[model samples]
Target chain A: MSNWRQMMPTTEAYLLDKVLYELHHKPDDLAAYNEDKAAYLARFRLTPELAEKISSNDVAGLYEAGVNPYLLRAHCIGMRIPEDVSLAALRSLMKEGDDKWLN
Target chain B: MAELTGIYTASHTPVMLNFPDRIPTELRTEIFGAYEAMGRDFEAGRPDALVVLSNDHLHNFFLDNFPALCIGVGESYESPIEHWLKAKRRVFTGDQAFGAYLLQEALKADFDPAFSMEMVLDHGSLTPLELAGLDPDLPIVPILFNCVQPPMPTMRRCYQFGKFLGEAIRRYDGAERVAILATGGISHDIATPRMGMVNREFDERLLQLMEAGDSEAVVAYATNQVHTAGNGAEEIRMWMAAMGAAAGLPFKRAYYRAVSDWYTGIGIGHFGENSLATVGSIDG
Candidate 1:
């Protein structure tokens, strides 16, 4: 169970991005999305490097470290990044947009 | 003839205590006195119910598409989670009849307002209730707007809604003297780098405009000058609506204080054509 949960999206950025993506495209399947996201995070183990990057406040680096930029931005700003920022930041930094997350 | 009774507008002072040094003794007395007077009126006949307009601060709604205007028609309401506010009481009842009437009137006027039966009152509502000395039992119709968050309503829309609200209250068949209260915003920022900024000059000017019953100017200023005043200045729209409801009536500036520490310009004033002198002192 611990290993499976570790593989899931544990970071706040990943959770937020998952929530946003689910809200926009597959809104009807939010329960499934949340459950799946939680499970995925539980399975995806947090690497020490990623943990250190977040703790060190390397916002951009943490995004590059396989942490969802959308989620990282939310954690950094202390609020959900506005939809515009979420879309733009994902595109410019991660080469990922709303569609990428939904898929 | 319908009796146009007391009209109250309050700024939600975030501070825990009524600091004497920050709020001058004279001003506190005057403001408290006005509230006492209003409280007395409520006890005497009380309006059929109070029509209150306040802003919601991310408690009921988030960044995802909050309505510009929403009303509570619930029979009972609770205060939101604010351990700091230290509200002395919990649970307030809503006047269903008045709420329904106001909703119908607002809709007739082309204002599409959302309704909630189970809603929580934030500091925006709690602070005004505290300052006004209102009994917890006072039946109220709560109207919440997205003032704190972005994608806010236009000043013109708020003013127009206030006008419609006044008409709605008058149209109600109930004989109870109706009082309208608008709470929140006298210049303070809660979000972003400029948090804790309070604009005394802007607040004073706003009070002056409200006293004059200059809705047009108030709306225009809200559109153009609110950002300069403070991000929280949008809460002033609630006051504009209350003023609209009491148009053509004499409004008294009962109390005014710019508490720099609290980052708020707190003021309590009343509107009623037949109310006493423009200024009076309350000794407590």
Candidate 2:
């Protein structure tokens, strides 16, 4: 059981995926979110902590919290974060042995 | 009586369609050629309907409620829901009767798969179909498994379901010629640190096992070493299902390339008598 392998998604992670899923599918919701981030996130009832993480583009933190990397990437895209920026954030969090899948 | 026309598996990466220029022109041509070849063979199957085994990419289902296995019984499905995918948006004709039959059979077989009358397919289903240039009019019975989220159906479970699916297809009195298209993976991580890394070693081994008709080894190897391959490799569960449906039939590889830029190890192949055989010719 590798540390990085997908585990059961936590409630916060699930909620994050929900928010991202909607934004990915619904352009209007995304536009609204981009316009008023707090008001948009408020509808989901996301905690201030989780909201802060997302608002700050905390890819590594979200990934560590078990947010599905796929959805997390989509979230970054929804946030208009560049692929390189998100990848760098994720890579910075990588541990020494996390590269086993790369072998 | 309805009979299995052909059994096939393919990698359904959106990049091949969305970012074909990411890879060199020669590789793109080769990959496209492979898909076209498979399409030609698949068309020759003359299947009245196709059973597509793929996973929803968080497009149709969300974490709030995700089913381990879901069958679409809709009269039709609109695909490439991303809207940004390079493929055109089109309505995929659905074989509702066949899908309903499969759902009933699945329930009777002790597999409680969820049923949907309204389902939209993401890249997982559309990419391969479009790349192959298959007829748009060809109706389909799409079976979506939870390959995206964890706690997904195990490789063995997928294979068993596939076997049951094969039995159900044989018992079908509705359509005479049916085909199965399982689209998913051979190794490459997605949205992770090793995102673009391709695990050719893992891909080749699995493909070889499938070609040799060693379902036991395939299931065992995939079950154990899938973590080493990549998270996206979980999509191999679909391939296991295809192997299950074509149990005892050896597979033939149509194409394989470890295109890192494509962000996945792409592989295509089919099982049974004639890898390229048309309808009524394949061993049911």
Give me the candidate number with maximum TM-score.
2
What is the Cα-based lDDT of residue A63 in candidate 2?
Answer: 80
What does candidate 2's lDDT look like per residue over B1-284, in tens digits? 78788998889887777668888887788778888888998888899889999998888888878999999999999987875567788999999999999999899899999999999998899988998899989889999998878888899999999999988998899898999999999787777777777777888788778777778999999999898777789999999999888868879877887778877888888987887522211110
lDDT of 2 by residue, A1-103 (tens): 2424457887877888778788778869878887988988898978899888877778888887778876876677556677678777777866676676554
lDDT of 1 by residue, A13-90 (tens): 353334433333333443553456444334334455544553344544554444432234334333234434433443
Worst 10 residues of 2 chain B by lDDT: B275-284
| Model 2 CAPRI quality | medium
Q: How large is the interface RMSD of candidate 2? A: 2.6
Positional deviation of B240 in candidate 1, in angstroms? Answer: 1.0
- Candidate 1 matches the true fold with a TM-score of 0.69
Candidate 1, chain B, TM-score (2 decimals): 0.86
